[model samples]
Target: MATGLILIFDKTHFSKYFVVPSTLGALLALAIPDLEGGAHDDIIYNGLNPNAVNNSKKYGINWGYDSHLFWEFLITHFLSLVLPFFLQIIQPKEEKITIKVLWKSIYLTFSVALFLFFFSWIIYAIVEKHGSPAQQISWNANWFYMGHKGISTLGELTKWPYNIISLTIIFFVLFWLVFVIKIYFEIYSFNLSYQNRKIRFFYIKRLKKTVFKENVIKSKH
Candidate 1:
């Protein structure tokens, strides 16, 4: 998803117009979920290990609520905000948006999302079967960990709402794929039209010059 936006906006002439909006759109997609209440409550309410040896280790601090919120902010929004800009500026500008580029982006996003989903499910299963420390670990790790696994577990145990959200994200990706295809076709058509126009104009100019030279030769003869 991040790569796709970068390629679409960064590699194209449209970058001047689309880059900021595409970046903001990606950030908005990631951030909106965190604003609402969900599984993060456990970490937010309880806090991190203060007295533990790990907490006392160098660079260790009991993050508690702040830590939880920080992680939530990072995963849910910050990473998304950072990634598009990073890709936009860092990647080689010469990269072209071929079909390979488009499909690769789609595949990468789906693969990452699916892996996160299943990884969360496994964590939830462990927490459900074993309990507590594991659950705590799962909750505290990162927003992606919680959002993917915790919400999935919640949906399974409760009813249908959680599942619906998961499914909706998947479908949204599908919709994005359609949009990507449309953009590719539009770019392709525009390029082809421009090339054809240039070629025709070149031929027309050459033909006019040839005819003018022929008339000059005839007049001299």
Candidate 2:
């Protein structure tokens, strides 16, 4: 999601205008839940250590709490769709962003981020020991890992996959920051070129009108 947002805002064109408000919606989606005493939805991770998994009594936010899984799921993902829809309605046609661009941005960013995640997963598999012979390692896909992870949230502090995943996330964020910065400058330059063309076109148009007026007056004389 973070990477997706970065991609969306990578242009000075409609992307920034479109991306920012939508991002706000996303932020609100995340923040409102926590503010209203809700917990973030997360993945339920089967731990490498049985003791750690046992420590996590629940997989995610308390089921009985005000933060129900249903609402959390809706708010976190769907609310973002509203912002772009409203922007499309009120925003000018020329400045409008296309769904293709949005999808491309999201796909490109996700591909890069996913690479990091998978790469780290490989490292973790090699280095991190699985649970004891009697313990089973399992991951719940209900949340699809976009949310929070299993019981040992704090217990992740001592785990091996913990650091690798953390590093992977951090790497994506840093790489994404640099990528956005480059795109920002490119967007600025692109817009500047457009502005220059508009200015030149305006002068050429005035010149044509002036010449036409001069010819009409001469003909009248």
Candidate 3:
């Protein structure tokens, strides 16, 4: 096996692409209530008729027993963001991986996760207590609003500027997740190619040495 050399991390590049976008993505994911939100009682009681007694929008992720700060934020959400980091930071460069980056990455992940959750909770609490949405914090009024009127018309749910901003953020996060997955696969392929080249080079060197020894022996004979 080839030994890897210590190298400096590209902190600027990492922060710009990896950390910042991930942080923003995570924040948006956590803060924004899921689209599949509905009141607890709003269920399809009958196949033909639906009971809208709860006035449930009938969508959004069920923020059930696992919605506590510890469960949702650090344990669930924080660890989830760290999964891609493990795959992406595969040290494929061999020489370009450093302890500083490793430690800094862990630190940044923890800090950013905490920060996002804190903001999410703060916004959630304020919105809950306020009874009505003061401004368009979430992109879709139909998506995650707790109290007051749910989306009456399609226009209410999908407006102009807010919709653009919200959809952009959502798409960004989706692309970012896909990107992380792609990076992992690309690194895996690169590592395999690198190992094959190294093996070929080693074999060629050994073959040259053997040929040189053979020639020397024949000359002596």
The numbered model that scores best in TM-score is 1
Tens digits of lDDT, candidate 2, 124-181: 4543466442221232111212222211333563134353355345434644463355
TM per prediction: 0.42, 0.30, 0.29
> What is the descending lDDT order?
1, 2, 3
Best by lDDT: 1
Tens digits of per-residue lDDT, candidate 1, 1-221, equal: 44446456744432322333344445445544433333334333456453443523323134334667547645645554565455545543433333344445445545654566666666656665677753545443333322333443334732222533554464457545644654444333322235644743222123444444432343343
C-alpha lDDT score of every prediction, in listed order: 0.44, 0.40, 0.39
Give model 1's clash tally: 0
Poorest stretch of ten by lDDT in candidate 1: 199-208
User: How well does candidate 2 match the true structure in TM-score terms?
Assistant: 0.30
CA-RMSD of model 2: 17.3
Clashing pairs in 1: none
Could you give me the TM-score of model 3 versus the true structure? 0.29
